[model samples]
Structures are given as structure tokens and as C-alpha cells.
Target: MLLDFGCGPGRVAGHAGRALGMRIIGVDASPDMLALAREEGTPGAEYHLVADGRVGGLADACADAAMCNHVLASLPDERTVLEVFTEIHRLLRPGAPFALLTTDPACAGIEYASLRVGEPGVSYGPGEAMPVRLRRTDGTWQSVRNHAWPVETFPPLLEGVGFTDVAQHHPTPDEAVGVADPEHVRSRDWSAERLRPPLVVTTAVKR
Candidate 1:
């Protein structure tokens, strides 16, 4: 089983459950999001509401592996980020892998397929408001503010919460071989993506 931390609307969590063929426990702080996830109904998946950064009904060290996708961007500061990690750590079994996916602050201003992060040549301080523009399906775009977390900020936090072997992977366009969707990869020019990845996945293990 896997725990999807800070799962919002269950888009990624649902897809992950189907692709990985594993039972996913999707938890979020928003009741509305959990309601939507339950309505969507992913096979072998469940949704729960997390309150005060705690997974209320879950026992300690119950989850096998856990992932947090695009969640740190919403947290305001390092203290809040650490609290979330600490709560997650309490639920993960020893040696369970924890994967955290976040938008790379370094890739700010680069226009990716689905979104464009921050402004060009604009430097955002830690936890400051980093503007992001996401492209809609209708070829329109919507703007939102996401908190900026430096790529280097995650390692010490993970290590502090009993996670070890921390590593960050910046996957480029050149590494897209055997991707599930080749057509999407060819939909746009990936040369810029090859130059710099707009996202980062940090992995660690509970110790």
C-alpha cells in the first residue's frame, strides 16, 4: 500500500494507483478534495482527511511507501514542511521509500508543456510567493502563487526526520524513452526541457 500525502482532487493519486496497481490511501487537508476523490472512485484506493498535519485514523508505521506530489509548494515555511515530514515519518514503516515531487525553483520562468514557473530572471526568497501560470486544455492559462522552496532545502529536512539515502533526480526530455505516452512527448519542442528540468523528485528511505 502507498500513502498519497496532500493529495488534492486525486488526479495524480488516481493515476498512480492505476499505473502502479497498488492500493493507495489518498489523504488531504481539504474535505472538498476528499469528497471529489471519493466521487471519482479509483480502484483499490481510499480517501481520508488529514487534520492539523496529522493522519487521524492511521496507526504509526502502517504505510509501506508514501509520496508527496507538489505539496511542499503550498507550505509557507521550513517549519511547516518539517511538521508534514514528521507526521509522514510516523506512518511509514522502516525502510519505506518516500518520494517528494516539487517544482524546481531554478526552472522559474521556463515555459513547460503544462505550466510556466515564476518570472524571468526573478529571484524568489525561501517561502516567498512564486507565481506560476498553468496552461489549460482550451489553450488558455491561469495564474497562481506557489511558495518557493530551494532544491537544496529538502535534503536536511528529510534527513532530520529519520530519512536516509536522500537524492534528487532532475529528469530531462532526453530520458523519456519508453514513456507511456510517446505522442505527448512529441507534441512540443523538448529541447528546452533537455536544457533544464522544471521539476524535481526527491527520494529517501525511513531509517
Candidate 2:
């Protein structure tokens, strides 16, 4: 089974289950998100609510792989990040793969069509904490605060949590850019530098 850690509204989980024909377990901290997932998920997609940094009701070593997407940067602190990592480590079978995707540290002040980079809420340096505002298709705005941890910070943490073979992957601008929608004002800009490696993806195996 595949576990989707911090799955919001079951988007990724549902897609993977339908597209790959995999059994998916989605876990998230929000009751509203879980409710939506249960209502609008794929045939083999199941959802669990996380409490106190734990995925309640799930047994240890229950999954073949786990995916965390856009979740770590939103964590309030490193302690929480480590706690989540430990929890993910606990849920995976031996040699199971753990994949993580988060904002790149290099995306601080760059401008993109869908997102506008704002001033750092905590510090002005790359790999520092900052606030970003996202523009929706309907012209609504959502603000998010994220920690831009250096790419180097991931492997050691994964290793500490009994994960091995940690490797980092960077996507090129062509692979990273989203398709532009003429109807949406916030559609992606194919020419923006922010489209270049806006995310960092890491994969490791549970030991």
C-alpha cells in the first residue's frame, strides 16, 4: 500500500490510486480535508486523520512507500519536522521508499505567474523563513508562511530517522512549469525563472 503523508483533500492520493491502481492511504491533520477526501476520493483511496503529530489507527510498517508533498515547509519548527519524519519512518516497511517534495530554498524573491514572493517574515536570506501569496484562478489570494530550509538539511534528517540512500532530485524548468490557462489570470508563466527548480524532491529508503 502507498501512504500519502499530509495529504490535503486527497488530491495526490486519489490521482495515484486511480492512475496507478494502487491502494492508497491518505493522512492529514485537517478534519475538513479528510471529510472532503472521503467524499471525493478514488475507489481505493482511504483517509485517516492525524492527531498530535501522529497518524491515528495505522499500524507500524504498514506501507510499501510514503509520499510527503508541500508539507514540511509549513511546519512551524524543526522539531515538528523531525517528529513527522519519525512518524513516517515508523509507518514504512523495511527498505520502503519515502519521497518528499518541498519548496526550493532558491525560490525566495523570484516572481511567478501564480505566486508572488513576499518579503521574508523572519529573515532576508535564502533558506530562511518567508511568506508567499498565491493567486487563485478566481483572483482570490491565499498567503502561506514557509521555512526555506537548505537542500543540505534533508539527508541528515532522513538518516537520523533510519532512512538510507537519500538522494536529491531537481526538476528542470521544462519539467517544472505548469500549463498556462488563458481563462485564468494566475496561470503559469513559461518564461519565469521561478519556474526553474521551484521545488526540491528527495527520496530515501527506510532501513
The C-alpha stretches of model 2 lying farther than 4 A from their native spots are 117-128, 139-141, 176-189, 193-195
Query: In model 1, where do residues sit more than 4 Å from their true spots?
Result: none
- In candidate 2 the C-alpha lDDT for residue 109 amounts to 64
Q: For candidate 2, write residues 1-207 as lDDT tens digits.
A: 999999888877877776667799999999999998888847867789889889889999999999999887777666888888999999999999999987665566666666655453323343456787787868788998776676678899899989999999875455432532234424344466434656678999999
lDDT scores for all predictions? 0.88, 0.78
Residue 118, model 2: lDDT of 48
For candidate 1, what is the TM-score?
0.95
Scored against the true structure, residue 98 in model 2 reaches a CA lDDT of 90
List the lowest-lDDT window of 10 residues for candidate 2: 176-185
Under the 3 Å rule for N, CA and C atoms, how many clashes does model 1 have?
Answer: 0
